[model samples]
Target: MRRPSLLALTLLFGTSIGLAQTTVETIAEGLEHPWALAFLPDGEALVTERPGRLLRVDPQTGGRTVISGTPSVDDRGQGGLLDIELHPEFADNRLVYLTWAGECDGGNATHLGRGRLDGDRLADFETLFVAEPCVRSMKHYGSRIVFDRDGYLFMTTGDRGERDRAQDLADHNGSVLRLHDDGSIPADNPFMERSDVQPAIFSFGHRNPQGAAIHPDTGALWIHEHGPRGGDEINRPRPGANFGWPETTYGREYWGPEIGPDTLAGTIPPIHHWTPSIAPSGMAFYTGSAFPDWHGDLFIGALAGVHLAHLRLNDGHVIDEERLLTDRGRRIRAVETGPDGGIHLLTDHVNGELLRLAPAAR
Candidate 1:
């Protein structure tokens, strides 16, 4: 097989790898704290604003139209619209799932909802599940969602400011939950037979997991979580695993004191960790042709670094890392791959922008 020339590759792909013209462009701006983005099969974009509205964007012109039927949100601290995901059979089902913070039993909690998408509205919507003992605090409402190969959903819940709750088996706080698509517990789940453990608990002793994705090759789950002051970690999540937080961590307290042990027994160490806190929010493994050289590499959106960080993976070890779009200085919230084989991102803050990162035009 003949390898295509740079110009030929550029012609084959929409964006060229030329140095003269940069390919990263800001498509939409002035978003109210954009949290997550899900691309439709037809190439349009569905983005969630942390303040509770969902907006759909025309891929051709970047025209944004707000979709109605969003639930009332608390929109406080770190709460509100968190993550949006499409059903595996979205093309035929028109089904989408969302995580949001809302009032539950007179307190705020993370809730999941499902709906069918109509023209510019959500129809036949229903709440799938709501967290129990709705915690009042807005911080640490871990709400990232991912699906396994068997189509089971994994939802991460934070400690809700109660640190000790992370190690408790009865509380759903600080746990990775596994459930069926329709909000039913699976019989084969890790904690299904344990009386003390909730059937929904897949793993325990976690601290605010915000980013999670399944590995393309091994099908293992990869998660990144934020720690207090420092000790941001990238971990390979395992069933019924204990990821020590509040007991063993590499982070210090916000007041400049040590929180606990630097490292302890039985707690899994991170594959990689950041010290000063990149505040990573979104992560993806590149498998697109647009950046062939970036294939199999991990890309993470850095909210505190105000840039996108790429890590080159070699046999499970991060051998190289790079930072891109540093000058733009936006709090990158989410990173996803587009249908056209391009990289897409959502920025945080009121005037957040939707950005597309691709090879520069040749």
Candidate 2:
């Protein structure tokens, strides 16, 4: 269904106005809790379902092919197959990377792996990295994989519901890690020289970060994490920086007690934050040409808010915000910029759908 232009809506309802006349189209439907989307070299795309399935979908026809040789996932509450990314040299290496919750010693932990795409199967799939000191909780398995411009792979991990773990540099929980492409610790990592800290850790003290993206112009890694009662945050993690979670949060506990002060002496504050908790999921920077007026804007999927957040940025800072697709009330699980400059979104539901947003026909 085509949505009325933001300009028209503003004129009719006295709401905020936008530049482009937008159209929302359903590209595919009947997907099972689709979590992430990545466009292949060709026009087709790869989609991951929370229940451990990978599908190759044609945007034009909605035809799907179930990819084989995927790793076994825990498939428990908030734990399953998650983010997927193509190798920077995918045209040459045919490698695809994925993150999921897998069975570990104590319980399940987020794992990273990759394999070559050989026809409809993943050939020689291998597990690369697994979060340490696995716990029994089914929540907070943060696992978003992003490759930076320098070809270094970055991964996010949650505190596994163990609030104290965020402050522990010895553990991988509640941290952003940087590593070589082959899952080896990078020599230049902030913690590499310190034997007391995990060598892969780039930054620590995060909650449960689910959204990550590299800035289109600056190439900095930006992430968004969920908070308890409020205080969802968007942060640009720096090397060895501490982002105070339990020790310094704007969110109150579920039981109505304050977690901590909003800012601490040494902790880095978030660039932007949400008070009512949007429960953000996927994120992407708009560099596509289809929406010229939207260039450089950031798009994020909101699970709790059930809308797509359109954030206008100025010089790396969020200047304005607009909520898109609010009428649908679909829990948007992922957001991606299509090769054609359209916006692609994955809805979270038993019978999920892949929707595309583009400039409306004049």
lDDT of each: 0.82, 0.89
Candidate 2, residues 97-212, lDDT tens digits: the string is 99999998969888999999999999999999988978898889889989999999999999989988889999899999998888999898998888899899999999999999
TM-score of each: 0.92, 0.95
Colliding pairs, model 2 = none
Stretches off by above 4 angstroms in model 1 are: 1-22
Per model, how many backbone clashes are there?
1, 0
The residue-by-residue lDDT of candidate 1 on 1-362, one tens digit each, is: 11122111121221223332336766777789999888998888999999899999875667899988777888999999888888878888888899988888778888888889998988888888886668879888888888878888888888888888788888888888888988888898888888988778888788888888887787778888888888888888778888888798888888999988877799877888888888888888887788776677788999898988878788888876767778778899898878777788999988888777766654
Cand. 1 Cα-lDDT: 0.82
The candidate maximizing TM-score is 2
Candidate 1 has a TM-score of 0.92
**With candidate 2 superimposed using the best TM-score fit, by how many Å does residue 121's alpha carbon deviate from the native?**
0.6
